[model samples]
Target chain A: MSDNKSLQSSRREFLGKSAVAGAALAAAGSGLVLTRMAEARAPDQPVSNKVRWGLLVDAARCVDGCTDCVTACHEENGIEQSGHAETDPQWMRKVELKDERTGYQLSLPMMCQHCETAPCADVCPTGASFIRADGIALVDRHICIGCRYCMMACPYKARSFEHETVTKQKPHAPRGKGTVEACTMCVHRVDSERLPACVEACAAAGHNAIMFGDLKDPNSEIARKMASEPSRAMRADLKLNPGVRYQGV
Target chain B: MAKMKNLYYRNIEGTSPGYWGLLGALALMIVAGLGAAYYMEHHGHIVTGMSNQVVWGLPHVFAIFLIVAASGALNVASIGTVFGKQPYQPVGRFSALLAMALLIGGLIVLVLDLGRPDRLIVAMTKYNFKSIFAWNIFLYTGFLAIVGFYLWAMMDRMVGKYYKPAGVVAFVWRLILTTGTGSIFGFLVAREAYDAAILAPLFIIMSFAFGLAIFLLLIMGIYGATDRELSDSVLRRWKNLLGVFVAAVLLLVVIYHLYKLYITRTHGIESFILLNGGVYTSLFWIGQILIGALLPLFIIFTKLGHSRFWIAIASVAVIVGGIAQLYVIIIGGQVYPLPLFPGMAASSSFSDGVVAHYAPSLPEFLLGMGGVAIALLAVLFVVKVLDILPESLGDAVLNPPAAS
Candidate 1:
């Protein structure tokens, strides 16, 4: 009698799950799912020029050995964790810094920086490297000839070339061999009003080292932090005016 | 009277078995090179030894060498027509042909090495005026047209009068072309090994040495094959000019290194390339300094240098040394670590804060060799079909019997 009762309950559970799956399939096939996806960021809306997306890192808060941000970035972006570090497509990496005179040691995540006048974009022969309207730098892999000139031009070594065929890439991130790539500053997530994976991961890890926001907006958290904190751009001598600012660096 | 008594021009007697053998060898190399390119392209850059740090490898060394040499090869034509050097006049046609062929070879390698060779049309159509590379596209194409027109002026009797004007245009264009090529490296503000005002002028001088070396070998090889009387006086003049260019190259190299050594910021890069960078340091001291500069200078300046064999040896030395120089400049420059912060030590998982390593793979080498084969084959085939060669460069024929 107990076995029979258990069988009946199992059947009921299967049927209920089948009903929900059926509704989801119908919703997907009928374009409802597509419309909801567009609701995150409208398809017809023009990218805002008034906003500049940036990341501010408080190096003091970042633990030297922790790699929560790195883990989050690679996983979120579907970057292959190929054991070969030299050839791997590293969109971002943890950089350890030490001042020779002061003996101060610090570590921070270095990425695209999304400069106002990006050298990568400036040196690209085909205009494949460009700054988006919202001030995020990007590569239009469509036109990147993979000449690696941009790689040479970049001061921070932020860009990476797709050395091998990319397999099982996340649908949200498009990548292939023979083109350049780098941190898009999580543009896909930013488009949908979501925080960057690295920023979220850092906060979740209780480090709260990385903050993502609109640098141009005075009221933004990142902007307010910059106003109050002692933060600076790496390689500021170049006058690239990078959007990614750092503190305790 | 000088025109009436000028040296006769004719197509090479191509019936020789040796000619066929040479062509076959070059063809095989071309096939091998093309196969390597296909494999690399199909498999992606993983098949090659290049990485993000050593982004450019052997293919670039070959391509840049050929391109720089292309400008230098045109010097013969420039001297003949613009400078009115009577001895160089007869060889102008071959010189122009060589210039075009070398450029074609270099460009083929450069395009094929691109991550998107198929999107070459996009590179042509698009424009990033700030980038020196964008300007090179125009410069390279313009070179071919202007030089081709100049060649037409030399060959076609109807347009013969325009030879001098065309030569001047071609000469000026070639200088700018080489400058653009040099500035490709010079314009990079970040690279400690490359970004310098001296690089542009250095490349110009390098072209003179590299281009002339290849030209010397070709002229001698063809003349020897045809059993033509190439006089010692002509050889001496050619060899001495080569010596001068090689010396000038050596001088610039010193200035380049010395200037950098004076700048403390560049000290790390300078020491790496000059003192203990292993292969790079050896190539700089031995390959470039010894074989490329000193040995060639020794051969061309001494009493035995007048011999055709020694002259030929000097030319080959120069060629080897030229490749070495370029290898140091292109590959060595890349392998050095890029300093992001001047006063701080930095490390990253991205190969930052470390000296990068690069080894040329077989496919990359083959692909580069294929470009070289294509260049040589073009030169060989064109000379056989056209009246590009003068009948003889003997002192007797060049001087003519003093008209009574």
Candidate 2:
């Protein structure tokens, strides 16, 4: 008698469970439909921007630990030097590199390449991380939940996490923990139609390792330099379409 | 909840106080952990042992170990629910609960280790399909759900009217879960030490060792609480299993390391680091292989099986040793500065320069304490409200048949 009762209860439980599963599936399906509908209704705006910022870095000439560009950019943008520097965003820094083959060494001033198809922005769950209208990948720190998923997603290791709270933070572009940040191509300066701090700094130091301009403008200094010079972006095969390129390391 | 009726408020007479004491201790630790997290959030991850050279430190090691243990804790559940080893069913619910608790603790520790704890959500938001860590997040969450349901079904069978259809689904799911965990460490191509395809199977074995040890301890603790004399056969069975797991883990460690050593190109620095003379050499010998692995192995294989007390001691040693092994695996790899400048020994030395090692800070330790406290408190509250432990009346009277 007890066995018969147990069998009946099991059947009842199974049906109830299957119903819950079916309802969840339906809800998920509807969410997909709603997303597709929204996408269909979106407007097709002009594909071109007036100033599409880009960089051309000359890797061959890059000297090891040359922080000229990094120093200048940090000063201009007022990035904080708090906690572990690597996990915190500095807009620009020099990366010491060593060649595996010939025991050769070089320094690559690393920063956000600002990929055309920025992986960081693409993977953001809340769309809090996005590529701006000005062609720069920036995090809306206000909306950012400080999930460092973007830090791991970037192939270049460009993004940094704010490890601690800061009391002495400069207000030029205030940042806090729990958010992902990286090189913005000096978005604040670009809005004012000024050169990025790193570009200015590199030019000031006479290394000319960096050249910034519009990639679309065929006659622009950046475009001409990029065409004539042997330049490369870090991990180009990633197809991230980086706005920045390396010229001579 | 409906399915968990039998487990509800089922107090194992003698063990209630110990469980409560454990819960109380956990509560205190959780309070400390929360305070630590708040301080760090307001201050920074700089409060921990991590620095630029050693980005991931103690918390990471602990988190990894907890994850491995969580995988291991499924052993009893696997045996009882999947394989239908009726004798092991009593431990299934406890093991599953412990597994879930440990996973939660591990995740908490991992998030605290992050420099940007606030940006932790980014891990979920910015999904890197290629990242093993990312895959682990999804896999772990899924495993928790499966195990949770399986345990619930078992509890229902014990207390409620019937058991849910758990046999095939739970078995298949747990196997995949353990295999998936192995893949997380096994698939890392960035580190040669982890590149061994055998790592997945080895991890599975490690899980068994960790899980079985913890289960035995929990069983003993419960027995103490209920004042029930454990069936001689059950105690013997546990000992036998522990013995087998320890031997297997030890063998795998040997085989895996030896295989790595056999590959000429990979052997030199990596092997020398563990075997010859390096920071890890001492840890490998004293903490992991000797005290943690071999000592526990000998204890279990020898006279320790004669008494529950000795068996418990050996299990604790295994647990401690297992946790230490995780530190060696995660931190050890990072300490060996990537030999990016491979050819010129001079350039490599200068470039790789002796990596400044890391040690966990006060806040990090305290934060870890907080996680443990939460798990303990959770278990305490769960057992309290649900009566997860069976009444000890029969056992208290020293008559097993009377209790039934």
RMSD of each: 6.7, 19.6
Per-residue lDDT tens digits for candidate 2, residues B122-221, read 6576654644555666777887777677667766646332343553465565556666666655654334456567878777888888878877887677
Q: lDDT values of the candidates? A: 0.90, 0.66
True contacts kept of 1: 0.84
Report how large a share of the reference interface contacts model 2 reproduces.
0.18
* Number of the top-ranking candidate, with TM-score as the measure: 1
Question: Model 2, range A1-249, lDDT digits (tens) per residue?
Answer: 889989999988999999999999999999998787564333453323655779888767666657888878777766667445434555666666555576576666777778888767655545666776657888887666654545435555466666656445556566766455677787766655578888888888788778888888899999988888677776665677888887654
Deviating ranges (above 4 Å) for candidate 2: A1-55, A63-66, A82-91, A95-106, A112-159, A167-174, A187-194, A213-249, B1-10, B14-22, B111-144, B157-164, B175-202, B247-278, B338-356, B380-404
Worst 10 residues of 1 chain B by lDDT: B1-10
User: What TM-score, computed on C-alpha atoms, does each candidate reach?
Assistant: 0.92, 0.74
Candidate 1 segments exceeding 4 Å error: A1-41, B1-4, B400-404
What's chain A's TM-score in each predicted model? 0.83, 0.75
- Writing each residue's lDDT as its tens digit, candidate 1 over B1-404 gives 12625488888988789999999999999999989988988989988999989999999999999999999999988988888887888889999999999999999999999998988999999989988899999999999999999988888889988888999999999999999999989888878998887788889888988888899899999999899878778778988999999999999889989989999999999999999999999999999999999999999999879788898899999999999999999889999988787788888888777888999999999999999999999999998899898888887666566662
